[model samples]
Target: MLSQLQKKLLNDFQQDFPLSPAPYADIAKTLGVSEQEVLSALQELKQLDFISRIGPVFPPNSLGNSMLVAMSVPEEQLQTVAEIINQFQEVNHNYHRENRFNLWFVLIGNNQNHLHAVISEIESETGFPAMRLPMIANYFINLGFELDWND
Candidate 1:
């Protein structure tokens, strides 16, 4: 569970990032703490694996292209197949989903053709057909939810 202070820090950071040379120092000033303390707290959070990364989250279509892919990998070879898929720099996120498809991943590429090529490569390498689901339309929803630390 995160302390109130940590939660407040995350909330503030999410809403606003300091637009200055020393961003951390600016954050410390806004949060009423020393710069060193802010840095230490961030490092501690990262060490605890609560925070995977602290940076910009880009718009998916801002780049050339992005697609969601699902593969029906055999249970025995799931790990090996996942590793192979993850090797591509174009592959951003991958997960084991509970479905007949089993393995799901996101691939972002320089263009639609490049994205298709990556999918083909994965299929050839893993010997599993990848089902590509390119986003034709999107409905943005405010999908924010608070975690109940006391639970």
Candidate 2:
């Protein structure tokens, strides 16, 4: 169960997140709370797994190179392989799929070379070949939606 302030933080600030120098402070001002309260709530939200991450979302290949990479890992090794891949700072997110390419993640790098290097490092560390699936098309989907607090 989440408190009202936690619910508000999750629902209200999904989009138009404060972009000022002290964004959390700005949010606290709007929410009638201290900046420490806002930061503590956010930390709790993350610890509870209500949010995976909070940051900017750049278009594919807009600021840097990015590619969707997949790996076929044995079921028993899935967790270990996923953790190994997550060690890379370039990896944005990784998830499991019910298919041969069960492990999939997006890697963003400064350039093509950096992208491939990270991929190679991941393969070497995990001992699994990565299938690079470059984005051929772009789609626009608003990631933010109103959270039903009542539920």
Candidate 3:
């Protein structure tokens, strides 16, 4: 069960989380709790699987160059390929989808050259040529949820 503090955190802090060096301390001050309390509660929430993670959701192409890559990976090798692809810092999300191309992922890098290099590395490492599907546009659904704690 989520405490009221956790509920407020889920609802209110989805976006606009502190960008300061001491971000947790900033959150604590705003939430009227000690920094440690905020940290502990967040840790507990993670432990309980209430939240997958707490971090910034960068806008596409805003922070750096990125691409949506698809690969025709054999089903038996999907797990291995995903592990290798995920080893790169550039790869953030890798998913298995049903299609001729089973494996898909997103890679981000400091620049366009770096992004292409990462893709090349992934293709070399997997021995499967990947199709580059760079984003021409982005669409997002606001994901914040409000917990009705009164009930």
User: Against the true structure, whose lDDT is highest?
Assistant: 2
**Tens digits of lDDT, candidate 2, 11-120:** 88777897789999999999999999999999999999998788887667888888999999999999999999999999999999999999999998888888999899
TM-score of 3: 0.69
Cα-based TM-score, every candidate: 0.82, 0.64, 0.69
Give candidate 3's error at residue 41 in angstroms.
3.9
Flag clash pairs in model 1.
Answer: none
lDDT, candidate 1, 1-151, per-residue tens: 6766577666557645677899999888888988998888888788888777787766668756999999988899999999999999999999999889999999988899999998998999989999999998778643344554556
Task: List ranges where model 1 is wrong by over 4 Å.
Answer: 1-3, 141-147
Model 2, position 117, has a per-residue lDDT of 90
What is the full ranking by TM-score, best candidate first? Answer: 1, 3, 2
Ranking by lDDT: 2, 3, 1
Q: Of 1 and 2, which scores higher on lDDT?
A: 2
lDDT of 2 at 25: 95
Candidate 3 clash figure, as a count = 0
- The candidate maximizing TM-score is 1
